[model samples]
Target: MEPLTEAQRRTLEDLYQRIDERVSPIAGTHAWWPCRKGCDHCCRHLAAPLTITRLEWTYLWEGFQALPPEAQAEIRARVAELEGTQRPYTCPFLDRESGGCRVYAHRPMACRTYGFYVSRGTGNWCHLILGLVEKHGDGDIIWGNQDAMEDTLERLSGSTLSLFEWFATEGC
Candidate 1:
């Protein structure tokens, strides 16, 4: 992953701020939103074998570079382990003790928006969030345009790679 240029960082910050503006208000409004500090359900279930654009990857690398060497090594180890795993892996950035993102500020858009995302399938949301949403039962369901967002990211970045593979090959 390349170092982020100043202009790129500015653009990234603005984009992230826009996302936070939307997600934060809605997330905070739901007092019962099950996405608490220790509840890293989505983080565990939705790890990176998924495609993320090069720009997003570079931004994430910037965050990874900021961590202390020990933390970076630990995260690298986690990423290495995931290289041979099957689908549905855990995020390397997860802090095991804290059960939180190590690079929350610089997490990719996919990481930023993991929730009861509306699926393209008939009357379905993401399965991982099903239990958390069961109690609400579709009363003003917190919808997420994950598909559209992915499309937008792909368009903007213009280069795509599997995140785990990217990590393994690119080196923190």
Candidate 2:
């Protein structure tokens, strides 16, 4: 994939910022939400099959390039281990010491979807994870599901590269 042009990068950043602003209130109001600073459970447990556009992939590749040599090697090793595993692995971009994403500014859509509400569509009931909701408390809010967003991103990007595949193929 080609590198993102400055304009493309700006656009992608704008899109992400908008999404973050729109989704934050919903996520912030959830009850049982243990998503406090230093809590890394979601990053540790969730499988992030990235559905990034080529431009987004380029941005992530840039992030990989910015890391120190040792950190880059570690990330590559982790990616190699996760390449074909059926189970999801922890994100290589997660900073274990900080309990936060090292590539926060360039994180994929899936990373931004946690701690929000997901509608069931059939009137079945909108669901928020109990643990999250209990911690954050329900405030008036609406948001899309992580699964739906992932599907939509995949469709829009016309790409099937999983997170690990993207990392490996992009020379990250």
Candidate 3:
């Protein structure tokens, strides 16, 4: 994979910072409040074929490097197994013991954008929004501008790699 141009890296970082600010407040509200400590329901599912930028890949590599050597080896082994299967896989960054992402700070956009409202289509499929309900119940808060944020991220980055592919190749 090619390295991200310095301009692309700056743009992506800026976009990430802006979205973090905007989403953090709304995420604090009741809609996403159920997402408390140790609730790993969202982490259990196999994620979609998320395409991240090369710069994002580099960032993820940095995070992986910070882990203890044993942890890194364990994760790389898991990733290798998953890659051999050629199917969707859970994030390698997820700590199996703690059920939390070890690289939460540098997690890709798709990881950060989950559990939020997203609208689609002109009728039944349209106006769909979802979020955490509560500590035990559904928070179901909706933010109208998430798509815009996603668009902005894509436009600014100019690079993309699938989440699984990223892990498979990052360590090679």
Highest lDDT against the true fold, candidate: 1
List, residue by residue over 90-131, the lDDT tens digit for candidate 2: 777778888987777777765665554353653212233564
**TM-score, model 2 to reference:** 0.75
Q: What lDDT, from 0 to 1, does candidate 2 have?
A: 0.65
The best-first sequence of candidates by TM-score reads 1, 2, 3
Point out the higher-scoring one by lDDT: 1 or 3.
Answer: 1
Number of the candidate with higher TM-score, 1 or 2: 1
What lDDT does candidate 1 reach at residue 112?
A: 67
**Stretches of candidate 2 exceeding 4 Å from the true structure:** 27-33, 48-51, 117-128, 132-139, 145-156
TM-score of each: 0.83, 0.75, 0.72
lDDT of 1: 0.73
- How would you order the candidates by lDDT, starting with the best? 1, 2, 3
Question: Per-residue CA lDDT of candidate 1, range 47-117, in tens?
Answer: 44656777888888878889999999999888778887876888889898889899887788876666634
Clashes of each: 0, 15, 5
Off by over 4 Å in 1: 47-50, 116-119, 122-129
Write down the worst ten-residue block by lDDT for model 3: 122-131
Error of 3 at 147 (Å): 3.1
Candidate 3's error at 93, in angstroms?
1.0
Clashing pairs in 3: 34-134, 52-161, 132-139, 133-138, 133-139
